[model samples]
Every structure is written in structure tokens, then in C-alpha cells.
Target: NECASPQKYHVDCDSNAVCVDTEEGYSCRCRPGFADISEAFNRLPGRKCVEAVNECLDTRLNQCSENAICEDAKEGYICTCRQGFVDASPNITHYPGRICNKPRKPDDDHQVSHQLDSCNPKDPRCGNNAICTDRKNKGQFICECAEKAFRFDDGSCRLSAACDVSNDCDKNAVCANVFDSYKCQCRPGYIDLSPDPETRPGRYCKELVNECATNAHDCSPFAECIDATDGYACVCTDGFSDTSSTAGLLPGRKCSNSSNECLDRSTHTCDDNADCIDTPDGYNCQCISGYVDVSSSANLPPGRVCTVQTTCPKQKTDLMFLIDGSGSIGSYVFKHEVLRFIKEFVELFDIGLDRTRVGLIQYSDQIRHEFDLNQYSDKSSLLHAIESTHYLTG
Candidate 1:
């Protein structure tokens, strides 16, 4: 009845799934997925299955953006919308799901920044009387003369000179033109200076009068000089040197001849043919090329010269003498002087007597003609007549 042992246990249960059991022995077993209910069996570890969800019906998914359907999937959900729908703040509003929207790319700096092509700092706004220059996209430059006006070569602006008005520079300064600017220099004759060229004008003419430093001869027996505001003036000295020579002289007042200096001191060339006798002030000569002295004596006294000397020498000696006989001489004294003058005059020209003749005239404030050479015989008779004349008293 109980025939099971390690050696012969199998003959008892081959059909019903029993086995012989020993240290090495399990005999018969059921196939996998088929359980042996009443028998003790070894079990394998199992996994918890991941069940599929329908996100469309699950409000917790919130998968759709706005105004769309949540398309459910086995794993998760997606948003689906018909065409032509938009939802603005679907995330905050939590309203209906959002529709399909275009994706956005990051913006470039050019799209966000503000720029000026010509006149930014490169082309900044200009000050008064200024001009703006542009180099490139962002390049801006300024050039001009300002209200006061100065100039620069490269980056700096410049001022120019017109000098129309004296105010272009200081009163004493001369405004000169430079490449891009104007510079100021002092007046030629004046010196001493101010700190600024613009503000301090004629104020810089601080040089004191160098009265004697130059040709400033301050005085003379003829005249004395005094300085005036702008320059100097002359005062007649008590002892007069008859500055009649300086009649209309200015600046260089001197005892020049009363006769016109222009008469002698002329640069005009003598184009006309003439013998020009040059004087200190000017010159006078006959136009010898065509003109001649025609005055000649028809009949003359014995020893008086009436020679015919021609071929005009450069100079024709003309003497004009002024004598003072204002009651200062005695009656006979006048006669003696006249006789002495005639004798001396004859002797002084003894060598040239043939070419020269002496004439006698008397003047005592009222010139009186005594005798002319056309009538007198010789210097002796001429002297006799001069001695007979009395001094006229005024």
C-alpha cells in the first residue's frame, strides 16, 4: 500500500504529476503558467503594470493650451485645435486649451537698439555757428567758427578773418588770416601788451613817449616841441630861426626852407628836355630843349657887362637879398655902406667882369630904383649915385 522511496517512488504516480523526492530529486512538474493548485510551488517576483490613461477626460492633465481638444494617448496627451484659433493668456487664465501658435526665435541686437547713421555723437547736435560732418555709419564731427569764433585743424572748429570791421581784433591788434584760423598781432609802431588779445585792445599801447630816443629833437632856437595825446606838436621858440622853411611841415618839423620842399624833393623824372637845377626841396630849370632867355640889352653904359654868353650852363645864378636899414644906420652911413657894397661887388667878380655886370638898387622898406646897368657907365659911377642916396626912415 505505501510503496514510495528514493529508489522506486515513480511507479506510483506517473499520470497525476507526482515525483520521487531525494536530495537530487524532484521528478515531475507542471509547465509554466499552469498551476498545480494543491501542491506547494516556487513563485517568481512580479512587476506592477503601468496602465494607459485617457488624458482627454482627465482634468488634471491640463494638456491643451486654449480653445482646443486634449488629444488623449496611451502614454500622455497633446493639444489639438482646429484652424484659425488663438488664445492669449491660456496659462494664467486656465481657460480652454491654447491653439496652435508660431514659435519665436531670440531677437538680434539690431532689432532692439536705436541708432543714427550720420549724426549721433558721431553726428551730434551743433553749437551756434557750427557745422556737422559725418564720416560713416556712426561717425559725426563738428566744424565751424563760434560766436567769438576760433578754429581747429582736425577735430577743432575754426574762425576766419574778414577784417572789414576793426573790431575783428583788438583796437591795437592786426588780425591776420591763418589756414583755418585768425591770429592777432600788435600795431607796428606801438608796444606794451595786455594778457588777452581780444578783450584788451588799444589798452596795450603803453609805451611811454621816447622823446629823445629817436629823432625827437624836442627843441630848437627856431622852435620847441611838445607831446600831444596821439603824438607830438611843436612850439615856436623865443629865439626864432625863421622856421618859415617849415611853413606847412608836419611829423618832421624842421627849419626847412620856407619855399616848398616839394619843389626840390620830388621823385618825378625830368622827362622834358630841361636843365634841372636840383634844390633842397625841389628843382627849377629852363626847358632848354625849346625855350631860351630872350631878354637882351640894346644899348648899355661903358664898362657895364653886356657879353653874349650862350650854351646855357646847368645853373643860372639868381640872387635875392633882403637888407635891414630900419633907421639903425646914419644918413651918411647908408651912403658909405652902399658905396662899400658896390666896390666889393665889383671886386668880388673881377675875374668874371666880362661875363658879369653890377646893378645898384636902394630899399628902405620901400624899394627905390636908383640906376640900372643898362644906364650906368661903371661901378665907380654906380657907387657915386649909391652914396648920394639917403637912408629912408619909417
Candidate 2:
């Protein structure tokens, strides 16, 4: 009856103990490994069996995790973790259920190891032309292009020059970089004729034509058509020239009347005491002022040679004089003094085409033509006619 109902008495025993019913009274005894600190049987009058010492309650005796739960046992204790907790130590054999740690998820950032062992040195495992790097998080890394290289449009890595604008091309032509080279193209008004795909890709601006060939030119009438690279020129003809040379090379060149280029001595055959005259064909030479040549039998050579008229032979000479007769000097002074002066001057020359010839004229407001040298053959007739000449007043 005691084993069946130990609480039926005035006292009760702990569940860890067994109750025995003697002939005299009921007694309480602890089960195996259990100890009773309270002497419940020694209680006065009636035995009080409610004292049991729990060994699991002592931290030294209970081996439980900091996050685990400790249960009381009869003689010892058992340590175990909560429903979702686990051991924190890497090796859990020695400290199973002693410390509780949350399970690490591969996707969780906090679960990642902060040590430098994340990257495997032996196996970088990166793509071609790429480098691997392990930054803040261990066991994780990123891939990047190698040195002096970049990513291409085809998601490929290559070694080549980088570009952001067309100016980076050769000769400032229109071009862009490819995988390991560049592609070239011609600009407006320029086209490629002979393309060599073996040496260079795409067309180059090498074979250029005159744009004016297809377009109208504003060249002047005096200009001629000249074909040039990438354009046409409107150049002045032989008798004409432009002050601006670029006008011909470019556009808007207008040919104008060319000035006499005789000033350039090297370009002309004119000699000293001569004048160079530019002509449509070439150039011509003429004697200068106050110069005459009596040689060559009255037929002047087409060149520059001059001598004083006084030094010429008498045959080439034809002389004339006009004496001022305005009311300043009286007719008496005119005939005597002036006539004497003339008489003396005429005696010094041989009067003929083969020698020398002479004529005379007197003028005030009106002119008097006495006689031409051709009218007389000898000096005696000329002197006789001069004496018979008449005088007039203003």
C-alpha cells in the first residue's frame, strides 16, 4: 500500500525515492545514487519525507551547454541543447551540447569566415585573362581583368589600345578598337579605292578624289581646271596669277589681270637702258627715253641697246627747234640774237640723211612751220631758205 500511495500518510517522499511500510510506520529511502539532505523520518511526531537533494542543480556536477538545458537525475545530470541550437566549437566531441551556436547558412554574410584562407592559392579558378581577389569576406572572391588589358564587347578579354573618341585613330581618321586591333573608315567627301584586308582591316582614306569633280566650282573665267587630290583647283593661266595660292588649292579662287612681272630681272631678257614690256606671248624690249641707236642702217634690232642721239651718225639724225616768241622778247631780238645763235648751231653738223639734217619752227600762241629737212638736199639751199623766212607777232 506504501508503494502504491506514498502520499496517503501525513508526510510525502520525493519522486526520486521509494516508500516502505513497516509494521510500526512508513519510511522513505532514496533511490540509487540519490541523497537526502533532510532527515524527514526524524521529524517530530510524524515523519516528514519531502527533502531531496538535486545534484543537477550544481554547476560543477551538471555538464550542460551555456545555451543548453540541465535536467536533474537520480545520481547525476544530462546536458542537452535547445531544439534549434548546436555546439559552437569546431570539434564538438569534447564539448557536445556544452555551448549553443546558431547553424551557419552559406548565403548569410555573417556566417562567412573572416580569415584569409577563403581563396585557394593552388586553384585560383578564374576565367582567362582574369585575376582572383579575396577581399573582406573569406572563402569568397571576385574576378577582374589582368594588367594592361580590358574587357571586349564579346565579353572576352584582350590586349589592345583603349579609345573613347575617333581622334584616337591613326591620322585622326574615323576608327575604333577591336579585340586586339583597330578598324578604320573614311570621313565625308573621302573614300577608299584600293583596300588591303591583309595589312589593315576596313577601308582607309588613302585614295581620295576631287570633290569638285562632282560639284560645281566657282572659278573665274580666266582660271583653268586642274585636278588635285581630294579636290580640284581653279588656277590662273600663263598671263594671269593669284596672290593667294591656297585659293587654287581650296575654293573661291578668282583669276584677275596679272601685273607686269618684268621687275624680276631673271625672267626677262631686257638689257641696260631698256624697258621690258610683258605681252600675252612673252616679253618685248624697247630703248629707254633720251636714247637712240644710229647703227644697223635705220633698222633697230629687237633688243636693248642705246646711245646718245648726238653720238648717232648724221644719217639717223632729224633735228627741230621752237624758239619762244611770246611778247617777252621783241622780234628784233628774235631775228638777230636768236637767228645768230641758230646760224652758229647749224654750221656744226652735216645736213643730210647720210650726215645730219635740221628743221626749224617759231611759236608764240600760233606756230609757224617754215620747211621740213626733206625739202632741201644741201646745207646751202637750207641756209638760203632760212634767210627768206618771215616772222610773225603774237
Candidate 3:
């Protein structure tokens, strides 16, 4: 009857316990697994003790927060701080605990290299010839043309270069473009037979001289000949083959023909107002005022006269000479010399073919008028007529 009472706390000697209102007779004993129900919080119910409740089994009734530690108790478990940081929320006897700690450690976003600064999408740090790339974990800057490509003056990359005369090639060689470099190509009649990387890296490159090409034969007989682009030439072809065999062409050993070794102008000994007159093996190039023939040849460059602005001489000559013509000029040289003299005279006067009058008189014992004074306009006609003279007698 006492054990059957309601609303009043009581227990039996058999270790059975109950809370009831009224009891026939009251008794104290253990409840469930308790050895002593009177002080179940710290003791056993009679000869029995309360079974331990697994607080960690079901997190709902006695839930332990992520920030706390759980410990088993007779009827529940408790939570506490784990490590590194303290729990910001206090413990609650009948509720779950709250978690509070320092901010979580920041993650490494730059998988490439975190030491570098963050990349900018607008003005990237990559160089002019490089590419700016932003990757998922990090950013990178790479050269666009690879390491082999050389940088240009404009901060761009070029596979080849603009070739000029100053490159490390023979005088007969020209500059050509190659991958990331410039190549020295032998002119038409020249080639590089060597297998040197500086010259003959490919089948088409060789170091050899071409002497039999067009215009190369235009050089006088006995003159050394060589090849040139668009043409070939006769000169001191060999650097060491001057007439004197000097370092280059010089006095006593000049770049000359069979006619006059002195005409071979390889040296210098003349005034600025004079012309070089050939002697034997060397020449003296008279540097005439207002004239420059660094490479003095019999054929002077068309003098840069006062053409843009004319300066006619104060003195003028209208008289002309007519010679006797027996037949024709005897030899080729004589004829050429005569014609050359005529050309020189005309060039000296800077005469216009339409401005002046010329006359021709060819006499072979009996006088013959080839042309009248008023018939020819300029010195060219007179020169031509004089050059056409034929000698019949001495």
C-alpha cells in the first residue's frame, strides 16, 4: 500500500521506488538502478545503484554543443570548452551550451605563391611582352614569346631582326632575318663554303666568291673583279691583292688597270682644288673644292652643281673650232678620249642644248661645212661634230 501511494515520495525494502500523493505506510528505498533513493544524487538505492546514462548516445535530451565536451553522469552529460579558445557562452543546468571562439584561421587563396601581392585585372604587373593570367588559387605572369625570343625596342618580341651593314658578316654579305636573330647572306656572286654557325648554318649559306657574273667583267683588263648585288665589279677585289699588296690600296701599289698603274688610286697625295693625275703604281687624288670622290675613279660622280639654284659664269665663249677629217679617228682609245673631252667641256659649261649655237667645219684640203653657226643649238652638237672628225693627212 505504501508503494502504491501517489504524489508522495516513498520506497520499498525490495528496492522499488515511487512518488505518490498518499501512502498507507511510507518507506525509503532505491529507484530503478539506484541503491539509495533517499540521496540518489550521491548514493546507491538500498543495495542497488542507478545505472549510468549514456549522455553521448542521444544529443537531443542532454545535447552537448560543438564547442563543449560531454561527460557521462547518472542521468545526463555535460559540455565544456575543447581547445585554442574559450567558450563565450556559460554552462546551463537544463539546456545545451553555446560556442564562441576566435575567427577561423584564414585559408590560403593563392596556391601558386602567396608571397606575391594580389593580382590586378586592369594594370597587371606582367611585362609588356608577357601575359597576365589570374588562376583559381593564384595568379601568374609569363612571357608571350618564350625565353628564346628577343625583346624589341618597342617592348615587343620579334622572331627576327632588322638587318643592317654593321653586322658581323663579310663586306660582300648582306643582312637577312632569322628566328630571333639576323643572318648575313652572301651577295649574289658570293657564298660561304664554311659550316660555321655564323655563316653557313643551312644548306643555302656558303662563303665563296662569284667573279663571273654580269657587269663584273666591266672592269678593265687586268683589274681584279668581284660580285655585287644587282651587278658585279672590278676593283681591288682581294683585301690583300692591291697592286702594292699593301693592307689595302695605297701608293706604289694601287687598284689599277694595265694602262696606268698610277691611275690605281689606293693612296692620297693631292690638294682639295686639284685632280688626281695617274703616274705609275699609285695616284694622287686632288680633292677639288666643292667636290668629293672618296673613292676616286676616272668617272667622277655627277657633280652637285648649283642646279636647284643656277650660277652661270660671268664669262662666256661663242667661238668654235672645226677640224679636218681625212677619214675617221684612228683608234678606239683616241675616239673615246675625244668624246670624253667633249663631255667634260659640256659639263664644265653646263650648257643647254637649246640655248647656244654651234658650228662645224670639216676640211680635207678642200673646206666642207658640216653644220652652220646657226644650225646647231648647243655645245652637244658641236662636241658630236668635233668627235666625228676623220683625218686624211698628217
Q: State the lDDT of candidate 2 residue by residue for 1-394, as single tens digits.
A: 5556655654466666667777766666757655553322222212233334564577776667666666563334445455434434332322334565433223424433332223354677655655777554575666545553454444444533333322333442444333333445443334454256344523455644433333355666676656565556777777666644444444326554565658688777565677888854356787677665322221345554454445444446777877776678787877766765565456545777556777888788898887776777687787676666666667
Per-residue lDDT of candidate 1, residues 286-360 (tens digit): 445334322112122221222233443223322222344557676666555544554444433322234444455
Note the clash tally of each candidate. 21, 5, 37
Q: Evaluate model 1: give its lDDT.
A: 0.41
The per-model lDDT (C-alpha) reads 0.41, 0.54, 0.43
Task: Show where candidate 2 strays beyond 4 Å.
Answer: 1-129, 135-143, 146-162, 165-168, 176-182, 191-318, 323-394
Task: Work out how many backbone clashes candidate 3 has.
Answer: 37
Shift in Å, residue 122, candidate 3: 81
For model 3, what is the error of residue 75's alpha carbon versus the real structure, in angstroms, after optimal superposition?
99
Which regions of candidate 3 are displaced past 4 Å?
1-287, 290-313, 326-334, 350-356, 379-394
Error of 1 at 169 (Å): 3.8
Q: Kindly report the root-mean-square deviation of model 3 from the true structure over all alpha carbons.
A: 47.5
Q: What order do candidates take by lDDT, descending?
A: 2, 3, 1
Q: What's the C-alpha lDDT at position 6 in model 2?
A: 50
The TM-scores, one per candidate, come to 0.22, 0.25, 0.24
Candidate 3 lDDT, tens digit per residue, 128-235? 334444544455533333233344444454432223212465565544333334445444333454357453432244433233322224444445544443335455
